[model samples]
Each structure stands twice: as structure tokens, then as C-alpha cells.
Target: SAGRPMTAINSSYYAATAYRSDRMPNQPPSAERSWIRRFAKFRLPWGLTQEVALDDFLIRRKPSSLRFQEEMNKEREEKQKLGTYIPAPYEHVNFHDRHDHESFRFSLWSKRSHFWIYLTGGGRGLFYIAFVVSMMTYFLMLFALDDPWLTTTVELLPILATWIFLPLFCWALGALVIRYLPHLWVKPSRGPIWEINRRTGLVTLFDYDNNGEYKKNGTIGELTAPFYEFDAYIATIPDRQGLVTNVLYIAHRYRDIVINFRPLFAPGEGQLCCALWDFLQNYMDTSRPLPDLPRYEQYRHLDPTTAEYDRKTRRNPRFWIDMNDATFEQELYAMRGKIDQIDTFQRPNLMARHVEYVD
Candidate 1:
């Protein structure tokens, strides 16, 4: 009797709220005028930006309650497990090891392997071009005859022959090189080898024991390195002295340089490390003069320690902490407030006040 009465009371309360004063207005499907006015006022320094209506932007079109509950459940589970709650498709921060002694040696070999691969590719390409030119020359001579039908027939034969035979020949040549060239060029070195991917920015390193056997403990894979989209195809072979010394310097300077030294020479692994290392070194070298600062007047009052000063140093108005400073955490939190203010000013459309309509 008690359960039945409680259920009836709850149902009545739900029915009352279902058509309550909080219900949205049933207006005609038309563009929002206020949004148009805001859009007209919103002029990007570059030019007039695209218009986004308020109804379309602010309307809660999707069912959010269930999704929010699921997200909360996921976060609770992650927290209970003592794991940081990362959104789907998260990337783990890569940590480099500073303790390894043979890291530089492996890096050098990896760079050498990349150079060899590049040289081989260039040779093959030149050979193919020469073959093509030769075919074109022969066809030109053959087609020099006065008979139009015979010339056409000869041209067709050359084209067909090239399309079929050249590819097969090249494949055979490549197979031969792959099978025999490693033995010839890759000498029995007594250290770890590293490699880089030319297409993907994947890096690998492998270490060998005293007997020249690849040690299981030494094998490492998928070392993350800074690789730009364009660096995918090009391979750089570092000069023996310059590359080895620089790698050693980096390893010594940076306490955390997590890299697998064993798989460095494997295809597609070594070159990426070389490219990334070069880029970072160039980027971080304070010896290089800073570029001309924009909006320098806005940041003149704040000291270098202040977030406002740092924002002025860069055009993007984002604050970055100097890693070398002892009060990094304090500086970071101070910058966070400044960053929030900048974000609010830059993205005004995102900060909309929730409005409830009453009948």
C-alpha cells in the first residue's frame, strides 16, 4: 500500500514538471536576429568571419543526460583505479632514458643506415630515368619512318613493353639488393643499431651482445621523436663526428632522453630521431636571436616573471614557463589565470549565459 502511494505521487510530480514554466518557446523556425547582429559586429582582423546563428549554436540538440552519466561513471572508475582520466585516443608522454651509455653509438649507426637507404633510392631512381630515356630514344628512331600505321604500331609495342617489363625488372633488382646488400654493406659492428621510418615517423633501436647476437633486453620499438609531416620521406645521414658528438651532448645534458638504442638501424626508425633531434636543438638554442615581437606595447609594464610579459614575448598570447626555473609550478598557476582571461576574450561566442523561459 505504501509503495503504490509513493509511485503515484512521483508520477504526478513528473507530469507537472514535464510541462512546467522551464519549457522552451515554440517559436517559428527562423534565423535568430540577435546572433546576426553579434556576427555583424564580430570582425576578425583577417576579414569578416562566417556567421553562426544563436539557435544553431546554443540549442541543445542532442540528448546529454545519459551521455553525461556515462562520462561520470567512466571518470569515477578511472579515479578509483588511480589512473588519470584521459579522453578516448590519448597519447602517453614519452620519457627518454639518460642512463644509457651506448645511446649515441646506436644513433650514429641508425643515421648511417638512413644515408645508405637514401643513396640506394637515388641510384635506383637515376637508373630508372636512364632506362626511360633510352626507351624514348629507341622509339623515336623507330617512329621516324614515313609509314603512319607502322609508326603507330611500333609506339604501341614500346609503351606496352615498358609498362610490363620495366616494373618487373626493377622489382627483381630491388629484391637482389635487399638480399645481398646488407651482408656487403652492413659490417659486423659490436654495438646497438637504430633505424627510422622514411614514410612514418616510427623509430626503433636494437642492441647486440658480445657475441654479436641481438639481446632481448636491448631491443626497443616505437621511440617517439619530433617528426613533422614533411620529414616522412626524406632521410638524413648525420656526419660521423657531428652527429655522434651532438647525440652524446644531448644525452649528457638532458637527464630524461627515453629512446630504445637497439632498433635504431631498422628501416624507418633512425632517420626520424635524427630529424627530430635536429629540429629541437635548433628550436631551443637561445643563442639564436629572438624574432620581432608584436603588441610589444601591451606587455611593457609587466616584468619578465609575470604572465603578461611572457604573453607579449609571443604573438599567440599563450604563456609558457621556463623549464629551467625553480618556481615553475608557481609561475604555471599564475599564467593559468592570464590564459583564462585571454581565452575568454578571444572566444566570446563560446561563453553564452544560460537563459530559462517562463510562460
Candidate 2:
């Protein structure tokens, strides 16, 4: 059942794998073909990799893992030296405590909406094309017309209005009408699509079917599982062109629910996804402080664990929000380099004690 107590889960058949390691076992591409139909066209980052069984790896949450701890410590020291670090500007696509101060909701809805808009060719693509064509037509008219500059500009106005402005206006008007019409009649999402509630230790996923016509149905669309019941996996799915895409996903041990993690981290390489998995574990574990990322610095005081951790360590609350943009960007570059050098496979699987295995 959904949202069952974590203690009720006694075992799993999958072997736990280190989150940082990209070494995946070779398995059949067709292992997940049944469910793959729904996500066949998901435009995730692609690279070459060996195809593996979808369920082959169970990535455990290991906040205490040595490499995770070391990298976090390094980040802390570097940021402190860079001056008071300020949290980056808030974005709708990532984690936020807006729903509940003690909880963090991770969202991909904005990105999903954008994807649909662009897929239909009615987003920036339409506006950009309209602007470019209008400019070219204006220049062409100036060269061909015999009138003086002002007269030519005046004469071109009607032509531009008929050939460009009116059509562009119609397209923009249609897009807004289409986008806003549903909201006028249909109810919006009942809750955030993905959320990790630190106070309750529950992870929620509001799953929506493929159709973009309607919002998620009531209780049938919701799935809430204990954070401990979730395991991360880096799925190496090959597309029709034979290019493999490495994407991160979180799945319930005993439920049919799976959350696509690509929109959050937007990992281009498999290793970045591993790092994000490490950070996510740290974020969810109430026993530990929040991962010292620029994004979470502002919310440190809201989470009990993080507040206490900051107090004990005498951490500056505005560690990220106060830094200059130039310095922050430099540190980001340095951090990326450090992340690339991280040894993902060296740490032993720390979920050994928490997860029971069945023969």
C-alpha cells in the first residue's frame, strides 16, 4: 500500500549500488520495453553507454558516506572563503520549502509545461520566427520602394501590419487563449508533484497520465511513500537512434510509482546524477544537516536538523546569498571540476544496515 510505514519493508531483491559509480552491468535492452512506451520520447540528455536491466541497481541513500561528506566539507570551506554565500535566485523547477517550511517540494511541472509548449512549436520559436521575418521584410521593402526614408517607413507599415503584425498577434492571442482556457474550466493540481516532507518523513508523487488535456485525478493520482522506501536508479535507456540516455529515477520498493529525476538535476553525464542522488539523500535525512548547496542555504533555518547544525557549526545564514555574482560563478566552476574528480565507487554501500535482503 502507498505511504506504508518504512519498517514494514523488510527486504528487496535488488542489490544496492553506490550512487557515484557509473559502472553498470550489461543487461538486455528489452527488459523495460513494456513501461518504456510511456517515456519513449522523453528528451533527456543522451550519451553512449551499455544497456542494462532497468531494475538491476538499487541506489541507497548514504548521507554518511565518506566521499559525500568530504565533498560537502570542501564545498563549505571554499564557499566560506569566497565570503558570505547567497542562495541562488529561486526557480520553480527545483526544490523549495514554499508548501511547508519544514518540507521541501521538488518540482518539474514548469519544465514539463515548457516542453509541451515548445513541442507544439508555439513557444519562443514562433515569436522568434515572427520577429526575424518581420525585420527581413522591413529591410527588403526599404531597398525596393522608391519613396524617401520616412515615406517608405510609412508605406511599409500597412504591408508589415498585414503580412507580419496581424498574424503574429493572432498566434500570440491563440497561444494565451489555449493555455489559459483550461484553468478557467478545469481545476489545477491539488498539490505539488514531488515533495519530501522532513517533518513526516514522507515522499509524495502526484502522477499524471500522458494526456495533457486534464489535471491529475483525485486520490488515484497520488502516491506517498516513506523516504526510506525509495531507491534511486540511473537508467541507461537507448533511443531509436541507438544513443543511450543516462537518467536518474526514484522508485518505491513495493509500489508501481517511479519519479523521473532528470528535470531536477538535468544531469548531462551519469556522474552528475550520482552526485545529485547523494545530495538528495542528505536533504531528506532529518538526522543530518541539509546539503550545503547554494540553493538550500536560505532555508537552513527552517529545517530543525539544518538549523541545529548551523548553530553548532556557527555557520553564516547568508553564506550564499551575500556573495558577489562573479565570485559565485568562479566557485561554481571550481565545484564542477571537483565533482568530476570525485571517486564515486570507492565508498561501500551504506544501506546495508537499513535495507534487509531476501534470498
Candidate 3:
């Protein structure tokens, strides 16, 4: 079993400390937010501060010879044939591509912002292109059929609605895609930057690709939370059997917007999540308990791999939109505030005594 066990400490996570720990605990928790106390006693109880600044990172690794890789590949093939390869839910190291061995930075905001995972202009293009192609294919097939199964497939003036309005539909979809894109996208190597302002506990996201310079409008996302909200949503990863595996998702969240791109966007399993979680563990309340990982269950709540997670989002270019529109924004905030705080959060810390790389 080559699975990377969940370690108590990951040094790689702590290697990029933006501020000293001694100075951080002493700073006034959230000084910039004093303007709100004047109006009412509505304070977000999640002790936030402004002492720390998330700046940069380092990914350390050791290379292996080509012969070693060949040997490993052969071993992997044999395991596959024998059905004994049990893959770890997430592996931070990309052994095949060497991508796991790189460093990147977090993007920040001009004001209160929370964690952000950006889809670049190029990434957006790929998204729209794939979406448009799939949609076009489906619609074309529908028209060719003698009749569609769905009741909404009515012919409301076929020449005007179906033929003429088809272009309009495509235009609208394309516009939506463009709206979600940053002006440019950074190379995957540089990655997107994420900042959690100590002052407000809010997360700010910066794109190193299109907005690396941190222009006035460089920020792609800003989300706020009141106190603490807790829940376990299912993250789906495909399996060899063609079905998907359901795992408990633990990452940054604010109401409907959840940011855990570790399994998808980050190189390897997601080193940043490990690092960020480790950092937060020091500041966050520990009396509360975190959600348990699953034993055996199918995911039923949200599916991040779909188009609806984007299209159905409130604003076209908005960051961290809800998985579903049924929940009201205010209700979400209230629900989060009412729920007990939990830090299912985990980050790699080298000092954790495990001799493991802090994520």
C-alpha cells in the first residue's frame, strides 16, 4: 500500500510562513473591521487578524533516474493487472510528470477577500469550447430526431425559434464563458494566489496569469463569513470501475461558495490545502470537532465536475457561486453562523514530528 497517510504534521505546509508565529498571536484580531462595531454588535466571532501576509511558496523534491521510472511503471502495470493497486484519495506528488515538485504564490485582494480558485482565460476558453461543442452536438442530434422525448421540445415556430435563435443561444453561452474568465491566465507553474486576511478571516484570490501584476481589478474573488459554518459535502473522484468514489471534502468556505480545488487544480493532491490548513490550525478554535471521513457511501450532494456549478452561479463572472440556487444568500450566511464551528482543516507542517513534508 503506497497510499500517503494523513500525517499530523507536514513541513512543506509551514515552509512558507509569511509572518512569524510569535508576532501573529499578539496582533489585534481584525483591526480593519472596527468600522462595523460602531453600527452594531454584529461581529464575526472567528478571531481574525491582519498580522500575516501570504506571499510565496517552495516545493522541494528529489529526482529519480529514467530506469527507476521504467521499473516503477512496470510494477504499476503488474499491480493493475492483479487488481491490487489501491490509489490514495489524493497524492500531492506527481511522480509521472514531475509537476508535484514546483512552487507558486497566493493572489490577494484590495479589500476583504476569502480563498479563491480561479479558472483562467485559457482555462475558460477550454471550458467554453468543450461546453459549446458538447451542447451543439446534443442540440443537433435533437433536431435530427423525428421527435424529442421531453415536453419542452415544442416547436415554437421552427424557423424563428429553432433555426434563427440557435445562434443567439450560442452567443449567450459564449458571453457567459467570457464573463467568468480573467483577462489572462498564468502558466500552471505559477498557479493562482490565495490570501486569507487575518483582519477579517476573509479570503482573497489573485490570478498570477492574467492579473499577476495585482492591478486595481486584479482580484477574481472576495467572500466573507460570519463566525463559523460547518458541513461535509461529497467530493467525487472517478474509480477504475467507472463509478465515482465519495470522500469528505474539507476546505475554505463561505455560505454557498466552497473552494477546494486541491483534487483538481493543484499539482499532485493539493499542497496548498495542506499548507493553508496547517496555518489555520494554530489560530482556529480547537474545542469543536471535525466531520468524519466516509467508510463506504455514494456521493449525493454536489458534483463539481459539471457545467451547472458555473452557469447557474448568480453572477456570470462571480467567484465561488453556490452548487445550487435553491438556497438564499442571507439564509446561507445565517445557517453557517448557526452551525457549530469545525476545522476539518489539515495542512502539512514539517515541524509536526512526522518527518513528512508539510503540504
Candidate 4:
């Protein structure tokens, strides 16, 4: 599986450092995490450190192969024919467009807060409905029925005050609590918890203690490693009902750092996760053109290798931008078929040349 060494981008020292072999190990073992540990890890907040072991399941270790490129190119060309071949970078993945071109940042706490809001908000909504129904019933009795027990304006005054003021006060208090309560448990992160930088070929993770407190002074919690120095894995976890959940994780080959962007992809998208792994390799490999997704279309020229490739091939600058929804859906359905046909494990690990492996 030995191949030509990576050529440094613009002969720059920083870019050259990404290709260093000293930090990588020869052979990484397949260490399956226990179901109990997986369950506990899933419950942990995102900013807290989740390190990897050498024995963790290893999926990808190097740049993608020609076969992988051919499959992706085939999908891109199919979309290009439909005029819906736009850049669908990480930012656009899972229908979220919050990320910038230089990096894709993800935070689990933000997602957790949203989950809590949905739950607590539902209960508050029921309370509002009950109050409305009760008020309607009370008014109907006082006006339409003309009941002897509810006759005068003075009697109505106290009843109306009770109905209006009590519900309004409760609703207002509930709203305030729902808005601020989650912040007390998990502090709103100052920035993204995980970031993958396209320009630097580096992946960074910010760590916090179990209590969700920043452990480092002046942002000392930031841990970064070369993109090529990590391996991808699928952590299959089963819930209490015996339903299995597949989570895609990336673990540093030498360091204890590990990160997952589960919120970016929906549950049961294991194949899509595999495709994402291939996309990351293509995007980070300076030797190849960037993945032809709609998000990267505008920034294609910024990457030296991608710019040169587009120039030599005369690739359309608006390939992804000029796409339509209908054709894009058609092409996406077909692309998934291609993705399913691919055997991610069939390809040899090109990391063999990039790192030394031991028995």
C-alpha cells in the first residue's frame, strides 16, 4: 500500500508538518468499547474530554484511494449533468448552514439545550391550553348560563382577576425558567467544542472538566493534531429497548483525544457517516482536489491544489451553485446507491506508508 509521499502545499513549513511520520504509530489495534462505556460516553456533554485507546476500532488512516475518488467523481458528474452538482460541504450537511469556509465547528451543549427546551416547552404549552379552556368555561357559565351563583360585575371582577393574573404570572415564570435553567447545568460554550480546519489540515478539540469547567488558563484546553494522524471508527451502542445506534468517531492515533459530531448526521446514517469519512480524506489531502460540494465551490480557488486541478481540467466554477432541488434530490438518491455499493474496508490502508506498523 506504499504510495508517493505527500507534497507540501506551496513548500510551506506548517503544511509540511502535517506529513510528519514521527507522531503516527505503525499498526493500530481494533479495541471495541464496552456497551456500558459507550452508553456513559453518549451521556457526557460534548466539551468534556473523550480520549481514544490504541485498541479502538480503526476504519480510516490515510488519504482515500483512486477507487474512492472514482465513485465520488461519478456521483459529481451525474449531479453536474442534472445541473444540481453544488458543493455540499460539512456546513450544509444534515441541512445545517452555520459553519464557515475555513473550518466546520460543532457543539453538543447547544444541541442539548435545544433538546431540553423541546421537552420543557411541551409541558408549558399544555398548561397554556388548560388555562384557556378553563377561562372559556368560566366565562360561558357567567354570561350565557346566567347562573344564580355568578351574577354581578363585582363577582366577575374577582374571578376574572384570578383567571388572568394567575395564568399570566405562571406562564411568564415558566418562560423565564425554560430560557435560563439549562445554562445553570451546562454553561453556554464560549466557542465551538470541535473544529476541523481545512486550511491547516488540523483537527482541534476544546476540553472541559466533568463539572463543565474550563481546566486550562487562557484557553490551555485546546488540543490539536494533524488530520492524517487520526483514524475513524463506528461506535455501535444499544439503548435500553435494544435499539442499536451507530455513532461515527475520530480518534487520534497517538494522543488520547477523540471526537464525534453526532448531531450533524441523523441516527441510522451509518453509510452516510462512511461517506463523510471519505469526504474528509478528500478535503484534507492536498495532493487531490477538494470534494466538489456546493459549500466549497466558492472557495475552491483558495486551495492551491484544488485551484490548479480546476484550471487544468477546466472545471465549472458554479458546478454546485447552479443546482435545482428536484434534480439534486434525484442525484442524491442515486449517490446513496453508489455509497452503499462501496466497501470501505476493501481498500488497503494507505497509512501503511505514512506510518510504521507493528505486529
Give the best candidate by lDDT.
4
Q: Return the TM-score for candidate 3, rounded to 2 decimals.
A: 0.24
- In model 1, where do residues sit more than 4 Å from their true spots? 1-135, 143-160, 163-165, 168-309, 312-314, 318-359
lDDT, each prediction: 0.32, 0.52, 0.31, 0.55
Looking at model 4, report the run of 10 residues with the lowest lDDT sum: 47-56
- Candidate 1 per-residue C-alpha lDDT over 92-159 given as tens digits, one digit per residue, 9 for 90 to 100: 32223211111112323344444555556655676677668767866676668666857666666766
Q: Write the per-residue lDDT of candidate 2 for residues 109-188, one digit (tens) a residue.
A: 34544444444455346556767787788888788877787898887777666665544665665567546653332222
User: What is candidate 3's CA lDDT for residue 203?
Assistant: 39
Error of 2 at 123 (Å): 4.4
Model 3 residue runs over 4 Å out of place are 1-24, 28-41, 47-156, 163-190, 195-359
In model 2, residue pairs whose N, Cα or C atoms come closer than 3 Å (at least 3 residues apart or on different chains), thus clashing, are 85-319, 85-320, 85-321, 86-320, 86-321, 86-322, 87-320, 87-321
Tens digits of per-residue lDDT, candidate 3, 1-359, equal 01111222223322233222222232212222233322321111122221121112110110122234447778878998999976542244222121111112243231211111222233445555655665675577567776753532444334334443444455554455445532222112322444433223233344333434434555444443321332122344565666644333333222333444343233222223332343343223112111111100011022111122223433232121212333334434543332223222322222222112111
Report the lDDT of model 2 for residue 85. Answer: 56
Each candidate structure's TM-score, on Cα atoms with residue i matched to residue i, is: 0.23, 0.53, 0.24, 0.56
| Best of the candidates, TM-score | 4
Sort order, lDDT high to low:
4, 2, 1, 3
Evaluated at residue 194, the lDDT of candidate 4 is 78
Error of 4 at 64 (Å): 31
The better-scoring model by TM-score among 3 and 4 is 4
Prediction-by-prediction clash tally: 25, 8, 33, 13
